[model samples]
Target: MEKILVVSSNKTASETLLDFLRGSFKCTPKIVESAYQAKVHLNSDVLTELVMINSPLMDESGVEFAEYVTENTTANCILLIKAETAEKISERAEKAGVIIVGKPFSKAILYQIVRTVDIAVSRSVELYLRNARLEEKINEIQTIDKAKFMLMEYKSMTESEAHAYIEQYAMNKRKKKSIAALAIIDKLSEQYL
Candidate 1:
């Protein structure tokens, strides 16, 4: 279930929103009265998926909390503000990459915002995972190249010959080329060190 942190001081509003979120999204939402309390939840390794910051957080505007969340965490945020403050709130929200939910919003609108957040979060995660895989591939290629260079220099083998040697070893041992390359690099390291 998605975990949501709600920063709001109004007990009635918080409770009402929590019920809506729970019923509509099956979200696990927790309420805090201040941005500081929200920070406490963030620092506690809660892995909150979304943060909903109600404008006029005890002593500060929700924009401050939203900005903090944007800078400090990967969680998506929805900043709720009064229509009168929409202009200011929207500027801050734009800078912080937060979604805006104007106060007195309809249930349908809130649900739509939550759905958009879910889609954005999923896309962010997918992009992150793809980048991680690409990085791993780059590292493997670098390691294999280093191993090939070592073989070429020490054993007087051509580049293709060194690559073929590693491939053959990997095939025979039922290992990946990256694994075989690491073993070769380890052996070379002992001699060079």
Candidate 2:
């Protein structure tokens, strides 16, 4: 199940919010009374999809916590603040990509914000995975290129010959071309070095 962390110093208010989240959202709600506790929850192995903070946590301001959450984690955050304070920090919240909900929020407002943030978190995760795959592909290509050069210079094989050699080795070993290339590079390095 998806997890959500709620930071609020007020016991009664936190309980109310927790109950509402449990009833309305399809997620596990974890409550923390201070920013420090929130950090502990965030650092745990479980991935949190959404974080909601009520302004003025026991040890730190909610805005600061929101900033930290946004910069350090992929989770999306919504900070509840007094209307006056919300106006003051609107720009900072926008820059940090945190959603700010002014105080005196109805349950409907909170639900909508959570829904929006959940969608954003999902998209961010997808993008992160896509980029990671692309990076791995780029690294594989570079390693293969370096191994090809090693074969050309050390084995006196032409470019096409070196390419074919690696491909054949990979097919015979049932390994990826990059893995075969890395093995060749390691063997050459061991012999020469």
Candidate 3:
């Protein structure tokens, strides 16, 4: 479970937000009353995955804190402000680039937000892992390609002859091209040893 820090001055408001998030977001929240505490929470090497702030605090407004957090911290930031007809809360959320959860948050909306964030995080992790695998595969292919070219250029072997030699002598015995490709990379890694 990710740790989501809630930095808010309004005790009742913070409790309300926490009640909504704890069950749905399944996040361990650290609530603070001022931006200074929020800063301290951020600066400390705690494993907070997200940081939230209330709309109004004596030290600073939520928007200011959100902006500061977005600019300074790696953790995702959000401003939780009561929904008003004036559009002030929305304007601040947009300008800060931090997410906003409507005031008097409903259970449905809370779950929806948590689920949306979950999907986004899942997709990001998937893409990162996929890219890593692709890089490894490319490196393996390059190593095999280099070996093939070396055989052709340095040993004056035909393409078919080189392929046949590797087929006969490779660790996988040419059962799979991927096996041979990876073997080439393994052989190259030995040189750095």
Clashes of each: 0, 0, 0
In terms of TM-score, the best-performing candidate is: 1
Give candidate 1's TM-score: 0.89
lDDT at residue 89 of model 1 (Cα atoms): 63
Would you estimate the TM-scores of all the predictions? Answer: 0.89, 0.87, 0.67
- All candidates' lDDT scores? 0.87, 0.89, 0.71
Q: Per-residue lDDT for 1-193 in model 1, tens only?
A: 3878888888888898899888988777888999888999999955788999887888687787888898899788888899778766677678778888777799899888888888878888799999999999999999899999999988789999999999998898899999999999899888875
- For model 1, give the 10-residue run with minimal summed lDDT: 83-92
Residue 123 displacement (Å), model 1: 1.0
Residues 57-173, candidate 2, lDDT per residue (tens digit)? 889888999999989986778899999999999999999988999998899988887877777777888999999999999999999999999999999999999999999999999
Ranking by TM-score: 1, 2, 3
lDDT of 3 by residue, 31-80 (tens): 88898888887889455657777777878666778888877876677666
Supply the global lDDT for candidate 1.
0.87
